[model samples]
Target: MGILKILIIVTNINTYAIGNLETGLWLSELTHLYHEAKEKGYEITIASPNGGNVPIDPESLKRFTLDEVSKQYWNDMSFRALLENSKSLNEVESESFDLVYLAGGHGTMYDFPDNETMQSIIRNQYEAGSMIGAICHGVGGLLNVKLSNGDYLIKDKKITGFNWFEESLAKRKKEVPFNLEAGLIERGSDYRKAFIPMTSNVVVDRNLITGQNPFSSKEMAKVIMRELGKLK
Candidate 1:
């Protein structure tokens, strides 16, 4: 097959709903997937719901929390420039990709769901046989997606995302607009979780891959690579 064309969508929300807490795209979530895909020479296109400067959650930049891969992208001015101007979902409607990745940040809780464009792209992409992946709150983008027959995309798919407890552990209970864990279960999704809290957990259900949190980025990227036939 030709090189896989990847579409990565990030959030444009820069604040929390309750306290206006600073939040945006989580740096590592994007970087891990980016570097892993870059290594295999897969083409990546970054976009957001609004198509402008993507906000970086302030907390994700804490020097103590960044991994080697995340740090590498942080120091590269060229990589940083990508977030400065992302394409809007409007521009991506006509495009088809081999993989559609949604990068998570707390800000995603503010905008990923109930988006007509987002739901349409996901439905179109998944139906077209593209690999669908999302990490942490990015999974929110998939929450409201319904297929043509009116079935939820994740209804019977085993999936995982930033759990409610993880949000509590992150001390963001009030900041989040909804309990993601409960929402998934409510939608008939077979949601799973990590054995431990604040750890990496990635669940694969056929074409869909969902990660538990920012910590799940590395493993999620590996899964994406494998799913794309880049790994054994």
Candidate 2:
């Protein structure tokens, strides 16, 4: 196929209620996939629920979270500009991309689940046979999408996300508005996760792909590339 296009969705919320912690898109979750896709000549677009000036989780910029790719992305002026002026989700069309990726951060718990524009894009893209992938808490976006049949898109689909234990490990379990794992299960998703918390686990079920945490970002990108016929 011609140059494949990917749309990446990031959260707009800038803070978590607990500890007034700063939160936004996990930098590695976007940069790892972005750099890999760019190197392969894929076109990528960044968008947000309300658009413009996407937030980077302050914690993600810390030394602990800064991998080589993320460190490079931090200093890349052009990439920073692209993120600073992301397009609004309303401007996205399902027909415009070959894949859609939801980048994760704790802030996603507050915004991804209830945005109508995001829900529309996910539903439309899935119906159009485009691949959909999300990592960590970003999977929250898929929880609310309904297919044309009025059924939950994730129903009976084997998927994985930031597990409950991870939240507890991060010490935000009680602070988050709802339990992501519980919510996914309640919605009929056959949610599966890594036996060991924080492991890089990725699950592919048909058109949908999910990764358990930031550690899974690179591997998830490779899977997306394979699914798009970019790799063996």
Candidate 3:
């Protein structure tokens, strides 16, 4: 097999409106996925709405970060360079990658929802048979993707993201752009989640993969890689 070109999407802010901020891609999500896929020799590229030095939520990194991964990640020049030179949403084409992994952060709610460029990239990647995965708020991108039949790609597919309950526990319930689980349901997603406290929970529904939080990133990637293998 050749190198697996993975496209990672981060967030960009739209407005400095009250309570809205530019949160960086979740470090745990990126580190977990990067290390696992790098071990397999996959080539990864980072992309954001504007591209260039993706911001990271320092708070999420504190709660989700590990010292080892953080150290190794910061030490890698190539990986750091990729982050610094990520393509802008408009610069990315669907056929350029074999997989697309959407990383979640508070900023995603402001940018991922209605970008025409992102939607096009998603449609092309999905139609071209690429593996698509998202974690936490990253699921925002799929809210409006249409398939070849002109149907919402995630419609009726079982998925999960950062639930409102978790948001409440974190005390940032009212700060988010929208309730992700509710929004997914509003768009006809068959969203499912485990019981209370929802730590380390993940759901894999066909080619649509999702995780409840940063803790679920690695497991989600494992599921995605497994599904990719089965695709052959």
Model 2 CA lDDT for position 189: 96
Instruction: Compose the digit string of candidate 2's lDDT tens values, residues 1-232.
Output: 6788899999888987777777888999999889888988888999998889889988788898788889998999988999999988988854467889999998899999999889888998888888999999999999999999999999999999987889998877877878999999999999999989988999999989999999998899888888888322
* Best-matching candidate per lDDT: 1
After superposing candidate 2, which stretches have Cα over 4 Å from the reference? Answer: 230-232
Q: Estimate each model's TM-score.
A: 0.97, 0.96, 0.90
- Per-candidate clashes come to 0, 0, 2
- Ranked by TM-score, the better of candidates 1 and 2 is 1
Q: Mark the regions of model 1 whose C-alpha exceeds 4 Å error after superposition.
A: 230-232
Candidate that beats the other on TM-score, 1 or 3, i.e. the better one: 1
Single out the weakest 10-residue window by summed lDDT for candidate 2.
223-232
lDDT of 3 by residue, 18-87 (tens): 6555366767777777787778787777789887767767665563465467557867887777777778
Instruction: Put the candidates in TM-score order, highest first.
Output: 1, 2, 3
Q: lDDT of each model, Cα atoms only? A: 0.91, 0.89, 0.77
RMSD of each: 1.4, 1.6, 2.3
Q: Where is model 3 poorest over a 10-residue stretch in terms of lDDT?
A: 13-22
lDDT of 3 at 55: 72
After superposition of all CA atoms, the RMSD between model 2 and the true structure is 1.6
